[model samples]
Target: MSRELFYNSQSAYEKIHLQNALIFELSKVTIPSIREIMVGQLNFINKELAQKVAAKVGVQVTELEFPNQSLPADSNYQDLQSEEREAHTKLSAALSMDNTIKNTIKGRKIGFIIANGVNALHVQDLKTKLEGEDAVVEIIGPSMAQVTTNDGSMVTPKHSLTSIASVAFDALYIAAGEDSVKELLMANNKPHVLNFINEAYKHCKAIYFGEGSEPLYMNSNISLKKHIDPAIVSWEDETPDNKFIDAIAQHRVWYLELERNTQD
Candidate 1:
Protein backbone atom coordinates (compact mmCIF):
# COMPACT_ATOMS: atom_id res chain seq x y z
CA MET A 1 0.00 0.00 0.00
CA SER A 2 1.23 3.53 -0.89
CA ARG A 3 -0.11 6.63 0.92
CA GLU A 4 1.13 10.25 0.67
CA LEU A 5 0.25 13.28 2.87
CA PHE A 6 1.31 16.83 2.03
CA TYR A 7 3.21 18.61 4.82
CA ASN A 8 5.74 21.50 5.05
CA SER A 9 9.22 19.88 4.97
CA GLN A 10 10.78 22.90 6.72
CA SER A 11 8.24 22.68 9.55
CA ALA A 12 9.00 19.00 10.12
CA TYR A 13 12.75 19.59 10.31
CA GLU A 14 12.37 22.55 12.72
CA LYS A 15 10.11 20.51 15.02
CA ILE A 16 12.61 17.64 15.24
CA HIS A 17 15.56 19.97 15.87
CA LEU A 18 13.66 21.82 18.64
CA GLN A 19 12.85 18.51 20.36
CA ASN A 20 16.50 17.44 20.37
CA ALA A 21 17.63 20.83 21.76
CA LEU A 22 15.04 20.59 24.52
CA ILE A 23 16.24 17.11 25.47
CA PHE A 24 19.86 18.28 25.69
CA GLU A 25 18.97 21.28 27.91
CA LEU A 26 16.85 19.08 30.18
CA SER A 27 19.65 16.55 30.61
CA LYS A 28 21.89 19.37 31.89
CA VAL A 29 19.81 19.42 35.07
CA THR A 30 21.38 17.20 37.76
CA ILE A 31 19.04 14.48 38.95
CA PRO A 32 18.93 14.58 42.76
CA SER A 33 17.88 10.95 43.32
CA ILE A 34 20.77 9.71 41.19
CA ARG A 35 23.27 11.93 43.01
CA GLU A 36 22.01 10.85 46.44
CA ILE A 37 22.51 7.21 45.45
CA MET A 38 26.13 7.95 44.44
CA VAL A 39 27.20 10.17 47.40
CA GLY A 40 30.04 7.99 48.63
CA GLN A 41 31.05 6.96 45.11
CA LEU A 42 31.44 10.54 43.87
CA ASN A 43 33.39 13.58 45.01
CA PHE A 44 30.46 15.38 46.58
CA ILE A 45 27.46 14.62 48.75
CA ASN A 46 24.01 15.41 47.30
CA LYS A 47 22.09 15.88 50.55
CA GLU A 48 21.28 19.52 49.74
CA LEU A 49 20.28 18.74 46.18
CA ALA A 50 18.15 15.88 47.38
CA GLN A 51 16.32 18.20 49.78
CA LYS A 52 15.74 20.78 47.03
CA VAL A 53 14.46 18.18 44.62
CA ALA A 54 12.25 16.58 47.26
CA ALA A 55 10.74 19.96 48.06
CA LYS A 56 10.03 20.70 44.37
CA VAL A 57 8.62 17.26 43.57
CA GLY A 58 6.73 16.84 46.88
CA VAL A 59 8.29 13.38 47.45
CA GLN A 60 11.17 11.82 49.47
CA VAL A 61 14.28 10.39 47.80
CA THR A 62 13.69 7.21 49.82
CA GLU A 63 10.66 6.69 47.54
CA LEU A 64 12.99 6.15 44.56
CA GLU A 65 14.16 2.67 43.60
CA PHE A 66 17.85 1.81 43.06
CA PRO A 67 18.06 -1.60 41.45
CA ASN A 68 21.82 -2.27 41.90
CA GLN A 69 23.26 0.68 43.87
CA SER A 70 23.84 1.50 47.52
CA LEU A 71 22.04 4.63 48.72
CA PRO A 72 23.70 7.22 50.93
CA ALA A 73 23.04 7.43 54.67
CA ASP A 74 19.83 9.22 55.63
CA SER A 75 21.76 11.41 58.02
CA ASN A 76 23.60 14.47 56.68
CA TYR A 77 27.02 13.63 55.14
CA GLN A 78 28.21 17.20 54.52
CA ASP A 79 30.57 17.50 57.50
CA LEU A 80 34.18 16.40 56.86
CA GLN A 81 35.87 17.17 60.19
CA SER A 82 37.61 13.80 60.35
CA GLU A 83 39.10 14.05 56.85
CA GLU A 84 40.17 17.67 57.32
CA ARG A 85 41.76 16.87 60.69
CA GLU A 86 43.98 14.17 59.26
CA ALA A 87 45.16 16.34 56.38
CA HIS A 88 45.88 19.26 58.71
CA THR A 89 47.87 17.16 61.17
CA LYS A 90 49.94 15.51 58.46
CA LEU A 91 50.90 18.82 56.84
CA SER A 92 51.74 20.40 60.19
CA ALA A 93 53.99 17.53 61.22
CA ALA A 94 55.81 17.49 57.90
CA LEU A 95 56.64 21.20 58.16
CA SER A 96 57.92 20.59 61.71
CA MET A 97 55.90 23.57 62.83
CA ASP A 98 52.25 23.62 63.74
CA ASN A 99 49.96 26.67 63.70
CA THR A 100 51.85 27.91 66.75
CA ILE A 101 55.10 28.51 64.84
CA LYS A 102 53.88 29.17 61.31
CA ASN A 103 54.23 32.96 61.02
CA THR A 104 56.77 33.52 63.76
CA ILE A 105 59.91 31.54 64.59
CA LYS A 106 58.97 31.55 68.22
CA GLY A 107 60.87 29.03 70.42
CA ARG A 108 63.08 27.90 67.50
CA LYS A 109 66.78 27.86 68.33
CA ILE A 110 68.91 29.64 65.70
CA GLY A 111 72.72 29.49 65.95
CA PHE A 112 75.05 32.16 64.61
CA ILE A 113 78.58 30.85 64.16
CA ILE A 114 81.23 33.52 64.47
CA ALA A 115 84.86 34.06 65.48
CA ASN A 116 87.55 36.74 65.70
CA GLY A 117 87.09 39.56 63.14
CA VAL A 118 83.50 38.52 62.43
CA ASN A 119 81.37 41.01 60.53
CA ALA A 120 79.63 42.90 63.32
CA LEU A 121 77.03 44.41 61.02
CA HIS A 122 76.07 41.07 59.46
CA VAL A 123 75.70 39.47 62.86
CA GLN A 124 73.64 42.40 64.15
CA ASP A 125 71.32 42.47 61.14
CA LEU A 126 70.55 38.75 61.08
CA LYS A 127 70.26 38.44 64.86
CA THR A 128 67.95 41.42 65.13
CA LYS A 129 65.72 40.24 62.32
CA LEU A 130 65.45 36.69 63.67
CA GLU A 131 65.00 37.80 67.26
CA GLY A 132 62.36 40.29 66.17
CA GLU A 133 60.44 37.31 64.82
CA ASP A 134 60.62 35.85 68.37
CA ALA A 135 63.19 33.17 67.60
CA VAL A 136 65.89 32.33 70.12
CA VAL A 137 69.14 33.49 68.48
CA GLU A 138 72.36 32.40 70.16
CA ILE A 139 75.98 33.14 69.33
CA ILE A 140 78.24 30.11 68.90
CA GLY A 141 82.01 30.25 68.52
CA PRO A 142 85.02 27.97 68.93
CA SER A 143 85.14 28.95 72.59
CA MET A 144 82.46 29.74 75.14
CA ALA A 145 84.51 32.81 76.10
CA GLN A 146 84.65 36.25 74.49
CA VAL A 147 85.42 36.72 70.81
CA THR A 148 86.33 39.95 69.00
CA THR A 149 84.48 41.38 66.04
CA ASN A 150 85.92 43.21 63.05
CA ASP A 151 85.22 46.47 64.87
CA GLY A 152 87.27 45.36 67.86
CA SER A 153 84.10 44.95 69.92
CA MET A 154 84.18 42.02 72.33
CA VAL A 155 81.27 39.57 71.95
CA THR A 156 80.91 36.47 74.10
CA PRO A 157 79.70 33.19 72.71
CA LYS A 158 76.70 31.67 74.50
CA HIS A 159 77.82 28.19 73.46
CA SER A 160 80.98 26.73 71.97
CA LEU A 161 80.94 24.71 68.74
CA THR A 162 82.44 21.75 70.54
CA SER A 163 79.87 21.83 73.35
CA ILE A 164 76.74 22.13 71.17
CA ALA A 165 76.12 19.83 68.20
CA SER A 166 74.41 20.90 65.00
CA VAL A 167 71.39 18.87 66.11
CA ALA A 168 70.88 21.29 68.95
CA PHE A 169 69.89 24.18 66.71
CA ASP A 170 67.13 24.33 64.13
CA ALA A 171 69.28 26.43 61.78
CA LEU A 172 72.82 27.86 61.42
CA TYR A 173 74.13 31.13 60.00
CA ILE A 174 77.80 31.80 59.29
CA ALA A 175 78.69 35.48 59.57
CA ALA A 176 80.59 37.39 56.86
CA GLY A 177 84.18 38.77 57.14
CA GLU A 178 87.39 37.37 55.70
CA ASP A 179 88.99 36.88 59.09
CA SER A 180 86.14 34.77 60.43
CA VAL A 181 85.99 32.68 57.28
CA LYS A 182 89.78 32.18 57.38
CA GLU A 183 89.66 31.04 61.00
CA LEU A 184 86.77 28.65 60.33
CA LEU A 185 88.61 27.18 57.32
CA MET A 186 91.74 26.70 59.45
CA ALA A 187 89.66 24.84 62.02
CA ASN A 188 88.39 22.42 59.34
CA ASN A 189 90.66 19.74 60.78
CA LYS A 190 88.50 19.65 63.94
CA PRO A 191 85.98 16.95 63.11
CA HIS A 192 83.38 18.49 65.42
CA VAL A 193 83.13 21.70 63.40
CA LEU A 194 83.08 19.92 60.04
CA ASN A 195 80.81 17.20 61.39
CA PHE A 196 78.47 19.84 62.73
CA ILE A 197 78.03 21.37 59.28
CA ASN A 198 77.94 17.99 57.50
CA GLU A 199 75.34 16.67 59.92
CA ALA A 200 73.19 19.75 59.45
CA TYR A 201 73.46 19.35 55.69
CA LYS A 202 72.56 15.65 55.90
CA HIS A 203 69.62 16.41 58.17
CA CYS A 204 68.37 19.04 55.68
CA LYS A 205 68.53 21.96 58.06
CA ALA A 206 68.66 25.50 56.66
CA ILE A 207 72.19 26.97 56.58
CA TYR A 208 72.79 30.66 55.85
CA PHE A 209 76.19 32.06 54.91
CA GLY A 210 77.34 35.60 54.35
CA GLU A 211 79.46 36.73 51.38
CA GLY A 212 82.86 35.62 52.67
CA SER A 213 81.70 32.38 54.30
CA GLU A 214 82.12 30.25 51.17
CA PRO A 215 85.60 29.26 52.29
CA LEU A 216 84.13 27.69 55.42
CA TYR A 217 81.83 25.48 53.37
CA MET A 218 84.40 24.75 50.63
CA ASN A 219 87.19 23.81 53.07
CA SER A 220 84.86 21.74 55.28
CA ASN A 221 83.93 19.50 52.39
CA ILE A 222 85.58 19.67 48.97
CA SER A 223 82.50 18.15 47.34
CA LEU A 224 80.31 21.02 48.60
CA LYS A 225 80.83 22.82 45.27
CA LYS A 226 79.01 20.05 43.45
CA HIS A 227 75.73 20.13 45.40
CA ILE A 228 75.45 23.60 46.94
CA ASP A 229 71.91 24.95 46.70
CA PRO A 230 69.45 27.34 48.29
CA ALA A 231 69.35 25.05 51.32
CA ILE A 232 72.72 26.67 51.78
CA VAL A 233 71.63 30.27 51.21
CA SER A 234 74.10 33.15 50.87
CA TRP A 235 73.99 36.89 51.08
CA GLU A 236 76.51 36.98 48.22
CA ASP A 237 73.71 37.70 45.79
CA GLU A 238 72.17 40.21 48.19
CA THR A 239 69.17 37.94 48.78
CA PRO A 240 66.39 39.56 50.76
CA ASP A 241 65.37 38.67 54.29
CA ASN A 242 61.91 37.44 53.27
CA LYS A 243 63.45 34.86 50.94
CA PHE A 244 65.52 33.40 53.74
CA ILE A 245 62.58 33.49 56.15
CA ASP A 246 60.29 31.73 53.69
CA ALA A 247 62.96 29.07 53.09
CA ILE A 248 63.32 28.52 56.81
CA ALA A 249 59.57 28.21 57.19
CA GLN A 250 59.45 25.47 54.56
CA HIS A 251 61.78 23.51 56.98
CA ARG A 252 63.26 21.46 54.13
CA VAL A 253 63.82 21.79 50.41
CA TRP A 254 62.86 19.46 47.57
CA TYR A 255 66.60 19.21 46.87
CA LEU A 256 67.04 17.53 50.23
CA GLU A 257 65.22 14.51 48.82
CA LEU A 258 67.70 14.39 45.95
CA GLU A 259 70.67 14.54 48.31
CA ARG A 260 69.16 11.82 50.48
CA ASN A 261 68.59 9.55 47.50
CA THR A 262 72.17 10.01 46.32
CA GLN A 263 73.52 9.18 49.78
CA ASP A 264 71.39 6.03 49.99
Candidate 2:
Protein backbone atom coordinates (compact mmCIF):
# COMPACT_ATOMS: atom_id res chain seq x y z
CA MET A 1 0.00 0.00 0.00
CA SER A 2 2.78 2.41 0.78
CA ARG A 3 4.47 1.49 -2.48
CA GLU A 4 1.26 2.04 -4.40
CA LEU A 5 0.68 5.46 -2.89
CA PHE A 6 4.08 6.97 -2.15
CA TYR A 7 6.78 5.12 -4.07
CA ASN A 8 9.04 7.33 -6.18
CA SER A 9 7.37 10.35 -4.58
CA GLN A 10 8.62 13.35 -2.60
CA SER A 11 9.21 13.25 1.16
CA ALA A 12 6.13 15.46 1.74
CA TYR A 13 3.87 12.52 0.85
CA GLU A 14 5.44 10.05 3.32
CA LYS A 15 3.48 11.42 6.29
CA ILE A 16 0.21 11.12 4.39
CA HIS A 17 0.95 7.58 3.26
CA LEU A 18 2.15 6.55 6.72
CA GLN A 19 -1.07 7.88 8.22
CA ASN A 20 -3.03 5.62 5.91
CA ALA A 21 -0.86 2.71 6.97
CA LEU A 22 -1.49 3.46 10.66
CA ILE A 23 -5.24 3.38 10.13
CA PHE A 24 -4.99 0.06 8.37
CA GLU A 25 -2.84 -1.40 11.11
CA LEU A 26 -5.13 -0.08 13.84
CA SER A 27 -8.16 -1.58 12.12
CA LYS A 28 -6.55 -5.02 11.95
CA VAL A 29 -5.87 -5.09 15.70
CA THR A 30 -9.13 -6.77 16.79
CA ILE A 31 -8.22 -6.75 20.47
CA PRO A 32 -9.16 -3.44 22.07
CA SER A 33 -6.48 -3.85 24.75
CA ILE A 34 -3.70 -3.82 22.20
CA ARG A 35 -5.14 -0.72 20.56
CA GLU A 36 -5.19 1.15 23.86
CA ILE A 37 -1.48 0.51 24.52
CA MET A 38 -0.49 1.20 20.91
CA VAL A 39 -2.34 4.52 20.77
CA GLY A 40 -0.63 5.79 23.91
CA GLN A 41 2.79 4.91 22.50
CA LEU A 42 1.93 6.41 19.14
CA ASN A 43 0.76 9.60 20.81
CA PHE A 44 3.89 9.79 22.94
CA ILE A 45 6.00 9.66 19.79
CA ASN A 46 3.99 12.37 18.09
CA LYS A 47 0.97 14.15 19.67
CA GLU A 48 -0.25 15.84 16.50
CA LEU A 49 0.33 12.49 14.90
CA ALA A 50 -1.71 10.68 17.54
CA GLN A 51 -4.52 13.21 17.22
CA LYS A 52 -4.49 13.15 13.43
CA VAL A 53 -4.01 9.40 13.20
CA ALA A 54 -6.83 8.51 15.63
CA ALA A 55 -9.14 10.94 13.85
CA LYS A 56 -8.19 9.71 10.41
CA VAL A 57 -8.58 6.13 11.63
CA GLY A 58 -12.05 7.06 12.97
CA VAL A 59 -11.24 6.16 16.60
CA GLN A 60 -12.68 8.58 19.12
CA VAL A 61 -10.60 9.52 22.19
CA THR A 62 -13.72 8.97 24.32
CA GLU A 63 -14.11 5.49 22.82
CA LEU A 64 -10.84 4.21 24.20
CA GLU A 65 -11.36 1.52 26.85
CA PHE A 66 -9.44 0.66 30.01
CA PRO A 67 -10.91 -2.74 30.87
CA ASN A 68 -8.50 -3.70 33.69
CA GLN A 69 -8.74 -1.16 36.50
CA SER A 70 -6.46 -2.89 39.00
CA LEU A 71 -2.84 -3.44 38.21
CA PRO A 72 -1.36 -6.92 38.32
CA ALA A 73 1.48 -7.73 40.72
CA ASP A 74 4.86 -6.46 39.49
CA SER A 75 5.98 -10.01 38.76
CA ASN A 76 2.90 -10.81 36.65
CA TYR A 77 2.46 -7.75 34.40
CA GLN A 78 6.16 -6.95 34.08
CA ASP A 79 6.92 -10.45 32.90
CA LEU A 80 4.01 -10.29 30.47
CA GLN A 81 5.20 -6.96 29.11
CA SER A 82 8.69 -8.38 28.55
CA GLU A 83 7.19 -11.31 26.70
CA GLU A 84 5.07 -9.02 24.54
CA ARG A 85 8.09 -6.90 23.57
CA GLU A 86 9.99 -10.03 22.61
CA ALA A 87 7.00 -11.19 20.57
CA HIS A 88 6.76 -7.83 18.79
CA THR A 89 10.47 -7.89 18.06
CA LYS A 90 10.23 -11.43 16.72
CA LEU A 91 7.24 -10.39 14.60
CA SER A 92 9.61 -9.10 11.89
CA ALA A 93 13.21 -8.03 11.33
CA ALA A 94 11.83 -4.61 10.44
CA LEU A 95 10.81 -4.19 14.09
CA SER A 96 14.24 -5.25 15.42
CA MET A 97 17.32 -3.10 16.10
CA ASP A 98 19.40 -6.19 15.28
CA ASN A 99 18.18 -5.56 11.75
CA THR A 100 18.47 -1.79 11.28
CA ILE A 101 21.46 0.58 11.45
CA LYS A 102 20.07 4.02 12.05
CA ASN A 103 22.39 6.52 10.33
CA THR A 104 22.83 8.61 13.42
CA ILE A 105 25.84 7.48 15.52
CA LYS A 106 25.14 10.26 17.98
CA GLY A 107 25.97 9.45 21.62
CA ARG A 108 27.61 6.22 20.44
CA LYS A 109 30.79 5.48 22.41
CA ILE A 110 33.43 2.72 22.16
CA GLY A 111 35.68 1.40 24.93
CA PHE A 112 39.02 -0.26 24.10
CA ILE A 113 40.68 -2.44 26.78
CA ILE A 114 44.43 -2.73 26.37
CA ALA A 115 47.74 -3.20 28.21
CA ASN A 116 51.44 -2.23 27.59
CA GLY A 117 52.45 -5.42 25.75
CA VAL A 118 49.59 -5.70 23.25
CA ASN A 119 49.55 -4.47 19.66
CA ALA A 120 48.86 -0.74 19.83
CA LEU A 121 48.53 -0.44 16.07
CA HIS A 122 45.56 -2.82 15.93
CA VAL A 123 43.78 -0.75 18.54
CA GLN A 124 44.63 2.44 16.66
CA ASP A 125 43.42 1.05 13.34
CA LEU A 126 40.14 -0.08 14.88
CA LYS A 127 39.73 3.33 16.47
CA THR A 128 40.36 5.04 13.12
CA LYS A 129 37.67 3.00 11.43
CA LEU A 130 35.16 3.52 14.21
CA GLU A 131 35.91 7.25 14.33
CA GLY A 132 35.48 7.50 10.57
CA GLU A 133 32.01 6.15 11.18
CA ASP A 134 31.49 8.89 13.85
CA ALA A 135 31.86 6.58 16.84
CA VAL A 136 33.86 7.78 19.84
CA VAL A 137 36.62 5.35 20.86
CA GLU A 138 38.69 5.60 24.04
CA ILE A 139 41.94 3.89 24.91
CA ILE A 140 41.60 2.16 28.28
CA GLY A 141 45.19 1.38 29.26
CA PRO A 142 46.05 -1.05 32.05
CA SER A 143 47.95 1.72 33.75
CA MET A 144 48.59 5.37 32.97
CA ALA A 145 51.72 5.50 30.76
CA GLN A 146 53.20 5.24 27.30
CA VAL A 147 53.15 1.59 26.23
CA THR A 148 55.76 0.75 23.61
CA THR A 149 54.31 -1.63 21.05
CA ASN A 150 56.14 -4.38 19.06
CA ASP A 151 56.79 -1.61 16.48
CA GLY A 152 58.01 0.77 19.23
CA SER A 153 55.12 3.26 18.99
CA MET A 154 54.15 5.05 22.17
CA VAL A 155 50.54 4.23 22.99
CA THR A 156 49.34 6.56 25.74
CA PRO A 157 46.55 5.61 28.06
CA LYS A 158 43.19 7.39 28.13
CA HIS A 159 41.61 5.68 31.12
CA SER A 160 43.03 3.05 33.48
CA LEU A 161 41.59 -0.47 33.33
CA THR A 162 40.60 -0.45 37.03
CA SER A 163 39.01 2.97 36.64
CA ILE A 164 36.91 1.93 33.64
CA ALA A 165 33.67 0.01 34.06
CA SER A 166 31.46 -1.66 31.46
CA VAL A 167 28.74 0.93 32.05
CA ALA A 168 31.28 3.49 30.85
CA PHE A 169 30.34 2.99 27.18
CA ASP A 170 27.66 1.84 24.74
CA ALA A 171 30.02 -0.75 23.25
CA LEU A 172 33.30 -2.36 24.33
CA TYR A 173 36.44 -3.21 22.33
CA ILE A 174 38.91 -5.48 24.11
CA ALA A 175 42.60 -5.29 23.19
CA ALA A 176 43.52 -6.86 26.53
CA GLY A 177 46.95 -8.34 27.12
CA GLU A 178 48.15 -11.21 29.35
CA ASP A 179 48.23 -8.83 32.32
CA SER A 180 44.69 -7.55 31.88
CA VAL A 181 43.40 -11.08 31.47
CA LYS A 182 45.14 -12.14 34.68
CA GLU A 183 43.67 -9.11 36.42
CA LEU A 184 40.16 -9.98 35.20
CA LEU A 185 40.48 -13.53 36.53
CA MET A 186 42.42 -12.81 39.74
CA ALA A 187 39.90 -10.16 40.62
CA ASN A 188 37.05 -12.00 38.89
CA ASN A 189 34.30 -9.52 39.52
CA LYS A 190 31.93 -12.07 38.08
CA PRO A 191 28.73 -10.54 39.35
CA HIS A 192 29.59 -7.04 38.18
CA VAL A 193 30.97 -7.93 34.73
CA LEU A 194 28.27 -10.50 34.21
CA ASN A 195 25.63 -8.01 35.19
CA PHE A 196 27.15 -5.42 32.84
CA ILE A 197 27.23 -7.78 29.87
CA ASN A 198 23.74 -9.03 30.68
CA GLU A 199 22.41 -5.50 30.89
CA ALA A 200 24.19 -4.55 27.69
CA TYR A 201 22.77 -7.61 25.96
CA LYS A 202 19.29 -6.87 27.28
CA HIS A 203 19.52 -3.21 26.26
CA CYS A 204 20.79 -4.00 22.74
CA LYS A 205 24.31 -2.63 23.25
CA ALA A 206 27.29 -3.70 21.04
CA ILE A 207 30.42 -5.61 22.10
CA TYR A 208 33.56 -6.32 20.04
CA PHE A 209 36.33 -8.51 21.46
CA GLY A 210 39.66 -9.83 20.19
CA GLU A 211 41.58 -13.03 21.04
CA GLY A 212 42.90 -11.61 24.29
CA SER A 213 39.47 -10.56 25.44
CA GLU A 214 37.69 -13.74 24.33
CA PRO A 215 38.02 -15.22 27.81
CA LEU A 216 36.00 -12.33 29.20
CA TYR A 217 33.10 -13.37 26.97
CA MET A 218 33.47 -17.11 27.46
CA ASN A 219 29.86 -18.12 28.06
CA SER A 220 29.64 -18.99 31.74
CA ASN A 221 26.43 -21.07 31.64
CA ILE A 222 24.31 -18.01 31.04
CA SER A 223 21.93 -18.76 28.22
CA LEU A 224 22.32 -16.23 25.43
CA LYS A 225 20.44 -18.87 23.40
CA LYS A 226 17.02 -17.57 24.40
CA HIS A 227 17.02 -15.07 21.52
CA ILE A 228 18.45 -17.45 18.90
CA ASP A 229 20.69 -14.57 17.86
CA PRO A 230 24.40 -15.07 17.18
CA ALA A 231 24.82 -11.31 17.26
CA ILE A 232 24.59 -11.37 21.05
CA VAL A 233 27.85 -13.24 21.54
CA SER A 234 31.22 -11.89 22.65
CA TRP A 235 33.11 -11.84 19.33
CA GLU A 236 36.64 -12.18 17.91
CA ASP A 237 37.69 -9.10 15.95
CA GLU A 238 40.98 -9.82 14.05
CA THR A 239 38.88 -11.73 11.52
CA PRO A 240 36.22 -9.09 11.05
CA ASP A 241 33.06 -9.89 9.07
CA ASN A 242 30.21 -7.84 7.69
CA LYS A 243 27.30 -9.40 9.59
CA PHE A 244 28.74 -8.98 13.10
CA ILE A 245 29.88 -5.43 12.44
CA ASP A 246 26.51 -4.62 10.91
CA ALA A 247 24.85 -6.15 13.95
CA ILE A 248 27.09 -4.06 16.20
CA ALA A 249 26.22 -0.91 14.30
CA GLN A 250 22.55 -1.79 14.51
CA HIS A 251 23.18 -2.25 18.26
CA ARG A 252 20.81 -4.92 19.57
CA VAL A 253 19.25 -8.28 18.98
CA TRP A 254 15.72 -6.99 18.70
CA TYR A 255 14.48 -10.38 17.56
CA LEU A 256 13.85 -12.38 20.73
CA GLU A 257 11.77 -15.23 22.17
CA LEU A 258 11.28 -15.60 25.90
CA GLU A 259 10.81 -19.04 27.42
CA ARG A 260 7.75 -18.97 29.60
CA ASN A 261 5.26 -21.36 31.17
CA THR A 262 1.93 -21.77 29.40
CA GLN A 263 -1.01 -19.72 30.66
CA ASP A 264 -3.78 -21.70 32.32
Best-fitting candidate, scored by lDDT: 1
Per-residue lDDT value at 259 in model 1: 49
Clashing pairs in 1: none
lDDT of each: 0.61, 0.54
Error of 1 at 234 (Å): 1.0
Candidate 1 residues lying further than 4 Å off, grouped into runs, are 1-103, 187-190, 221-228, 262-264
Worst 10 residues of 2 by lDDT: 255-264
**Model 2 lDDT at residue 143:** 64
Taking all chains together, each candidate's TM-score versus the true structure is 0.57, 0.49
Best by TM-score: 1
